[model samples]
Target: MSDDELRELVHRVDLRIERLDARFDALEKRMASVEGRIESLERTMTTRFEGLETRINTKASNWVVSLWGATLAVLIPLLTLWW
Candidate 1:
């Protein structure tokens, strides 16, 4: 093959490589954006779950305390009668 023809082929290959590199860079930017959004969503979900857990714990504790109070109110009177 002629030197000119070989040079032309090499130049074409270089252009193709540059285009591929640009495409890769664009893809990387898009992936980074998606990763950032996912992280934000995860943080929001975690905060919401933590708040829900706190509410559930508070409600359960209140229920237990109320139940204990009611049980004692009934048991104490019965025990006194037996005594």
Candidate 2:
């Protein structure tokens, strides 16, 4: 091929490479954005789950206290009557 033809070919290849690079950069930005959103969602879910666990624990503690109190209330009077 002539030198001029070779130069033209090189220029076309360079243009293609630049276009590919730009496309890759755009894709990378999109991926970063998606990753950020996923992380945010994960944090929100974790917070909600923790709150649920705390509420359950509080309810269980209250139930335990109430059951013991009721048992004592019933048993104490019976023991006093028997004695």
Candidate 3:
């Protein structure tokens, strides 16, 4: 190819390279935003699970105590009458 044609080709290639670089930069920014959102979602779900676990544990203990109280209330009276 002539020198002028070669120079034109190089110029077009350089322009294409610049456009590709810009696209890569934009993709990196989008990925960073997505990563931040994922981290926030993870933290929110973790908090919800921890709270649910605490409530379940509290309810289980409360039911156990209530059942024991009720059993005693019924048994003591029956035993006294039998004696």
Candidate 4:
């Protein structure tokens, strides 16, 4: 090929590469935004799960207390009557 043709071909390749680079940069920005959104969602879910766990623990404790109180009430009367 002539030197002038080779030079033109190189120029076209450089322009294509520049366009590709700009597209890749835009894609990277979009990916970062998506990652940020995912992280925010994860944090929100974690907070909600923690709140649910706390409620469950509170309910379990209340049930345990009620069961113990009922058992004591029944045993105390039985023991008094027997004595």
Model 1, runs deviating above 4 Å: none
Top candidate by TM-score = 3
Candidate 4 — worst ten consecutive residues by lDDT sum? 73-82
Instruction: Report the C-alpha lDDT of model 1 over 1-83, residue by residue, as the tens digit.
Output: 99999999999999999999999999999999999999999999999999999999999999999999999999999999999
Residue pairs with backbone atoms closer than 3 Å in model 2 (clashes): none
Residue 57 miss distance in model 4 (angstroms):
0.8
Taking all chains together, each candidate's TM-score versus the true structure is: 0.85, 0.85, 0.91, 0.86
**Tens-digit lDDT track of model 2 for 5-69:** 99999999999999999999999999999999999999999999999999999999999999999
Number of backbone clashes in candidate 1: 0
Q: What overall lDDT goes with each candidate model? A: 1.00, 1.00, 1.00, 1.00
- Candidate 4 has an lDDT of 1.00
Superposition-based RMSD of candidate 3 using all C-alpha atoms, in angstroms = 1.0
Q: Which stretches of candidate 2 lie over 4 Å from their true place?
A: none
